[model samples]
Target: MMPLIADLRNPAMRDRHWKQLMEEVNKQFDPHADSFTLELVLDLGLEHHQEAIAALSQAAAKELSIEEALSKIENLWETLPLDLAEYKGDYLKLRSVDDVYSALEDNAVALSTMKASRYAVAFLSTLDTWERALSHISETVEMLMNVQRKWMYLESIFVGSEDIRKQLPTESSIFDAVNAAYCKTMRELQDAGTAYKGTMAEGVLDGLNTMDEKLDKIQKSLDEYLETKRQAFPRFYFLSNDDLLEILGQARDPLAVQPHVRKCFEGIKSLEMKEVGKEGRKVHEAVGLNTPDKEQVPLASSVICAGAVEAWLLGIENAMCTTMAQLLFKCYADMKKTKRERWIKEWAGQLSLCSGQVAWTVECTKALHAMSEGQKTAMRQARKKQTTLLTKLCDMVRGNLGALDRKKVVNILTVEVHSRDTLDRMVKANCASVNDFEWLLQLRFYWEAGTDRCLVRQTNTT
Candidate 1:
């Protein structure tokens, strides 16, 4: 048990054996009843490993010594001569014996005094501690720089554009916190006049962690905002965050979105944009779907704005839905005159595609224009009409199936086939999807040529 505990001190070994240790513990104690955690088991093992405890104690002591030394250096730097300060920057940049000689030639007196200082002696005496401390401070400084740069960029964007500020109001407080932290840290570092002061070092390290937390919060908020937009117009999901940001930031400029028009709309290759009215408002009024002939379809004009782009895009989708619904009804009307097998197949395919678009557009528009109660009522009515059309299309197709040729109906029922194979055959023969066939198959009874039978059971019924 002692040997196993010692072996577990190695991190690699502990990770590999973690599951085995848990299983072994479960044998003696009920994990559910005793509520035994892995932490408790590790603590038990660690208590017996006195040598590991000693090593940990020594590490913590070393860290304390380094901090004390740094704190003393910060105090000592105040009394140190101005010449000594000149050496501080150059000495910190030193990497080798050659660099030390090069720095000495530039500030020989200060370099000589710095080399003999007690702080320098302490640094040399504990090279490992100094290395770890310096590395940590460097990493924290780098993090601070990155956070400041990002905040500046985001701040400039929001400050310069009133439209963006109004559109994403939730980001105001988060950015304010980031701005305050960044300014406070920068002020402290500037007042200290040096990066190596212990107070600034500790503060910056703590600030770096805080910035990381704030950065994560900002990302979550941004994701939620983008997700809401995507829900309103699902095509926005295909765009990257940068691409979406660019479109939103320059929402007033219609041409800025021209490049991404194809990505957001499937059939559209580009938009025909123009300025109109006394206000000179830009609008996307037409989309050129990349057909083989390259014909353009005009959409209802929508004035571009930071918050209104989603509504504009949904308007285009709603237009497509209306067109598709009309085409589906036209197919249904044509079916009444001629119940040809090919015509039924084409109608089924159109119904399937049209139904999906109609349902999606109705839901999309509802959320996109959620603030308008009138618009919601209008969408509800539109959805009802589209639903009725879809139902009629399905019913007409099913009726046409009942009127199939007598010989084709016999050939289908008598064939030795699995349910899956039967559905596949029916889909291919009728040029409909498996869904359409399944809907038709739910019927328990069908009459054909003056005979009644359970169509799916392949049984005769008087």
Candidate 2:
């Protein structure tokens, strides 16, 4: 046994010992020998072979263990497990020679009487199991290493640089910087998910979901903050509901009310400009906007505040457009009513004067013709001045009647004259001569549904 052990320690001696043992076994075993004796000898030889193989396996395992220990000390296999769990159970179940030898010995005795072919088959089967087990261990180690590397990469993304770290949400705030960073990271993670499939994809998706949760929380906080700001600065945030209601109530003619509403809008715009300018100046001063690299430098808080202000400004502008549409309609109604009344009174006074001149001319045509050349020139000048005044008044009235419907004008005229008969009588009484009657008829049509050209023709004929 000692010699066998000593021989087993050396390569050449071990081979020679195995050769000599086989020779002795062949010499000892004969076809004439009893079956029990042959079986016992074969079993003994098989047991020794198992013991030698076990010793070799132990030495190899010890060397691998020492190497693994050194590797651990160097931190070379940091993510790898230090246990033999992958090799345990069905594949290479026993860790030591004693246990393996005992287990094999029990099976070896039963297989001692079996054919050599059967024994060879069993040995090959065990080797195959060990080979598959080793392959599994290799794959598992690689997977663990990949997972560890991915974990480190994910952690680095959050704390890689000062700027990056600053972008992450702290306990107090989750405004511009954090929001921007979250958006950027979310996009990167989505890209990574597409780039890395299978196992790595799982990790990437997990990280993305985590980031999404954080962003969701930050968004909720930001929304709350913005709401508070809107409440605190109502004028800057939105148009007042009461003012909008008032404008709606007053609107009568949508087409004619625009000019008045536009005036209001201009006033609101001026106020917004002043407020934005004032707030922007304060923000600039606070964030050192005079710095040479101000564009590059991210003034996160100031930028966030400015964004809120700008959003509010946009909201108010939209509201004004909507509100003024309604308010302009109201202004158009009021202006049209006032202007129509004033125009009627002025036209009546002018008509009375022109009629008086026509009546005078009709009653004293011969007397006027009999006057001196200078008197005739004075009378002609007076009539020309009156005609010019009438033309100017007609132009003013036409301009003030912008887009007013013909039906509305007729209704207003009917109300003013009390009756159609009264209006006809007035027209007849105003016409003192042929030209005067023509001018008066033109004035009636102009007030009803006629264009400025009608009055132009009347003045030309005069």
Candidate 3:
């Protein structure tokens, strides 16, 4: 990259040669685009090519053809910096903008696929079938999430975790896509009912919904965790109860542990976690299966941290589910927010505003001319509100990540306890004198403390 620029840097080119080169470069954009002209770059750069970087940065911000320009700017960025690595870090922060663009593309693909019934597309449909036959769908999905989440975390840790001062924005965009597709899939399948006939067994739809909800929850947690991790190591992921306690320097009261009454994690050892992919399927069959033909759900699994919902709603979104539609609405809201944030960050630099403003709308008469009034308004509002909300979303993520890192350094965690009596106390005393031992279902056991910073520690049986 540096060599290419060096080849172009000639004293002969600086005079009349510069004008011709500028004209050639300027022609690379749509005539309709106000944001990408060689004259504007020169104006923004103000004679110094160093300022040209900022001009390019600002232009890259507004230009919808962002992904391509980012690659070009990246090549250009390489030749201009002394501390090349740190420049790379800043570039990474800006690259989160690329993540938003990529997400928008993925959502567009999924939506188009949904509209075209592309789940019926060979690969996706086979993937759907693969959902069944697997013993524990939730466990399978959860492990897939664990795989996906860890892959993402590793990206932040290894690829971007060079300097704490320079924040590298992690790309977080899976749930919006999965949720959008899931909802659309449900509607498609339901409406095409009879048209695409297949008798879903009892509890299958319930199980599928559960998997989708869990996936949504996983997406939310990973986003928050990644943000928190931005400030600290993403240790909360694989820490043990005892290690967590040791880090905090003291155990939080068994009475405080968190949103749930008890925190009993069955997976994770050290900072390493294995992919529970096929293994989870086995565990599902071993623990969940009973009859010759029926499939079963698992009795144990990891309880993913809900920092996103916790930070935003001040509790878990799971508890808000009085109905599936409400749950769908929440998923939709989350999807909308994620998509909006992606677009705003992606195009913010391109949008020329009244300088000094944190946010202001610039009408695109040509862009919106083809759309109906309602859609145009919605698109415009989305652009504005998305810019505002994304700022908050980023802040919320940073705050949670900061807390998570501090907790890691201090080695403390805060989880609350439950109030129910354990073993046979409730069984004998609350139930009847006949016997606490004589019971078919004793499905409630997680009553303990919740919340606060606590040290990482070892696992103990309930």
Candidate 4:
């Protein structure tokens, strides 16, 4: 007569209520029953649970379809810089040795009126433009190599993942259809990657080789010019005034006379007369004896102007060469540093994305298996409990019910106690273990942290 304590209408509470009712029935009718009949009743519930598990497995398998896998691969492929036309255009713009030769010819004519030192300075200044052009070519070559290496690495990843996707079983007609489409797209991407490598070799590499040859020729010419200037300029500084005058007076080469006279006057004027009066008197004697006319002193002044021009030219040339050498060396050092840092950063990011995708797929597969195993365990426990309840019921009904009536009663009770839909829902809800999800999250964190540490270490080393 007491009101029912548990709500049988609630799906969540129905199993408990049913178990309590069956226990009461056993205590009232019979207290010692065998479990063979109970085992048969629970077998029916196990069959229903098995059908639910199959449905869940099929759903999990569909989640890793070819379409999703291809999408990830395509995203990685798109990151490659495969514009061969841009590389070709940039390579063509580098200045050739012929261009540097033409510039030197023009500069030489402009510097002809200046002294040897001035000519050297002007020539050295001209080398700066060539140095810049050459440095640009070097940087471009480095960039191209980096791009080629990056593309090759990405291509390998795409090809490897494609193979994995292909090996996965085709669970349905839809999977087969999607896989066929994915294969076609992957092949096109592979072909494109191959073409990019060919383009790099044919265009950028060839261009770099040509630039290097031209630069070497130009550098050799500059070195020879520098040596000639070094020998010629020192003569103007150390030559005796009388010897320079004799050379100018005899002047077998008319073109060389003015330069010798200029050197003579420069030697006399540059003397530290107070510091070395003996040299100063000799310089005075040479000028006085050679100059029969006072007007010739002004001619000597003109020669001194020529020497000043040479000094000016050489000073500028030496400074420009030093500045340019330092500049180019700095540029090379900076380029290397930048390339190394960029390589590490980009490689780490790409590797992280790749490994993260693989890990996610593996985790999904593991979770699926875990869920299936958990469901089996739950079903086994359910079967054992049902068998025990049925055994109790059999003992209670022995005297009151005949064999056929007892079988009918057991079938009715089993149906009332186990709801197939409710068991299906419970198995689905409880199948994915919380512990598994937590473990997966922890693994993902470690992977990301490790990637970050690797990047930091590489950056510090650089």
Residues 188-251 of candidate 2 have per-residue lDDT tens digits of 4334332112213334334444544554565455345445544654442344333322322222
Predicted structure 1: clash tally: 0
Ranking of all predicted structures according to TM-score, beginning with the best and ending with the worst: 1, 2, 4, 3
Per residue, candidate 3 scores C-alpha lDDT tens digits across 147-169 of: 33433333433343333112222
How far does residue 180 in candidate 4 sit from its true spot (Å)?
Answer: 47
Off by over 4 Å in 2: 1-202, 233-400, 403-462
What is residue 289's positional error in candidate 1, in angstroms? Answer: 5.0
TM-score of each: 0.42, 0.21, 0.14, 0.18
Most TM-score-accurate candidate? 1
Candidate 1: the clashing residue pairs are: none
lDDT of 4: 0.35
lDDT per residue (tens digit) for residues 1-462 in model 4? 011111212223223333443453332211134532434424433233433334333333333232243344334324433333222232111112343234334434433422233223423443444344334434544543443343333223323344322322232223334224333332332454532232233344454344344334433443453345446555444455334333323323223333344353432222211121365342111111112112111111111112323453344334434433343333333434554223222222223233322333344335446566665464435434445544654554554654544444455345424433323344455545424432233222112233232121111231
What value does the lDDT take at residue 313 in candidate 3? 18
TM-score of 1: 0.42
Models, CA RMSD each: 23.8, 25.7, 35.8, 52.5
